[model samples]
Target: MTSTPISKISSGVSRRNFLRTGAIGGFLLATGSATAMLTGCAKSVPASDRLFLREQDVVVLTALIPIVLADALPTGEARAAAVTRTLAAIDGFVGNTSPAVMDQLYQLFDLLSLPPARVAAAGLWSDWPNASEKDLLAFLTRWQHSSVGLFRAGYAGLVKIITAGWYLLPESWPAIGYVAPVRVV
Candidate 1:
């Protein structure tokens, strides 16, 4: 019987190590591809046109508002109008905020705009238009209920902004049963 030397018997790298390396490489490749695809898919927003929120930012918010508001959001054309008005309100509010706050919002929006980041952070893989109400609600619930502080903060921040912006619209007041204060001459 011939005995094979230990060095020659097996390769230096174990199967586990090989798999680990492959997995890391695969992840990097996938991430890069997703980034490229997302970048290509992004609509170019003119710098001058953006006051506080970019087009992508609006997309994220519009997709999320209905889910965040759920039953509170009206149906059909009213919902469409509400989304538009609320987005405008959010834009105005964002513009008025301090530069630091605005920067944070921009960062968050940019992060969400990336496909991989959106999937990892928001648990959303498809475009907002393609996402179902159930999926959106699930994502929100996960973030809200997550053990991580960052996820909790993300949930709180999004909910606060969407709800606040929506309620700020005069049309939304009646829905929420908030009567406007009487004005004295």
Candidate 2:
């Protein structure tokens, strides 16, 4: 697995400090829940529709999948198919997590769903559907290098989720020269 380098900040806002202040919870309450209510996305979706990720989360991942996968991602019509499959894998991964972890993931997704928060936190002014590759890259780069520990944590979580989701798929194994172990009789 490839590791992302994070630079330390000289500021007083450490990860512990960020969590202790409940800023993320505040963001979720103020923006995420409000946006969800306004957009009617707070309603529970049917079981068959989605496991964990909401429709808005899908939009965010759809934009991010290609950029994160890069050369490993297939091109042409297959590109869309690959992304779809990877999303399913991601859903499965998220679905199996504990409820607390799931809630945290949802908070992150919801935060990104808000336009104002998306712009301020990710530097993504446009919706995920309309964001260019350059814009996406810049956002990822900024988060990776951000002085704020929370931003760095989010960056790490996102990259780990995306990469893990993609690599967990059997179809993606061949690309990285991974072959499942043979069973012993």
Candidate 3:
């Protein structure tokens, strides 16, 4: 396989992955082939992949950012590196870092925002040991009610995120049974 500049991003990908990552305007997606990604599945990172957005998802994410930040598109090209870092953290943990997947995920987020992703991600966070599960679920339910789109996007986006992110991990496989409530329904 051809070499990539970033390790955290490339190290996790697999042959199954068809992910890409870059700015919406200048995104560079390569899934072992320089094919156009406007259409087609780009090959499934994993058919039953769940809870992560892959490189292609990054397309959605990067594009969404321009929309999200239309009011304030980060000064001097820094583009809030922290946001990338935060995404990287979650992406690393979730493990879907394909270039295409990354772009798609960014579009998903750009369409929404931190509040929405965080809200959808609540399920992941809700299982915290210290907090009262009752209160958390209650809050999650309420949060769910408020941001159905956010919740949906989060789950969908996360699925793409993890799939592309884990494209390269040696022992990795698509996660199963991570059913996001209402996501299926």
Ranking by lDDT: 2, 1, 3
Task: Tell me the TM-score of each prediction against the true structure.
Answer: 0.72, 0.79, 0.25
Candidate 3 lDDT tens digits, 1-185: 97654544745643333232122112312321123233334343521343354554444444333333333334555555523533454546544356675555444433223233323334333223333546444543543453334444455554444344333332222333333345453
lDDT of 1 by residue, 152-184 (tens): 766788888889888888877998799999999
1-185 in candidate 2: lDDT tens per residue?
Answer: 96633332665566676665477546535776777678776654513667988788898999999998899888899889999999888989888889888776776776777787788678898999999999999998988987655677778888889999999888889988998999899
Is 1 or 2 the stronger prediction by lDDT?
Answer: 2
Please say which candidate is ahead in lDDT: 2 or 3: 2
lDDT of 3 at 58: 48
Shift in Å, residue 63, candidate 2: 0.5
Worst 10 residues of 2 by lDDT: 3-12
Q: lDDT of candidate 3 vs native?
A: 0.40
For TM-score, the strongest prediction is 2
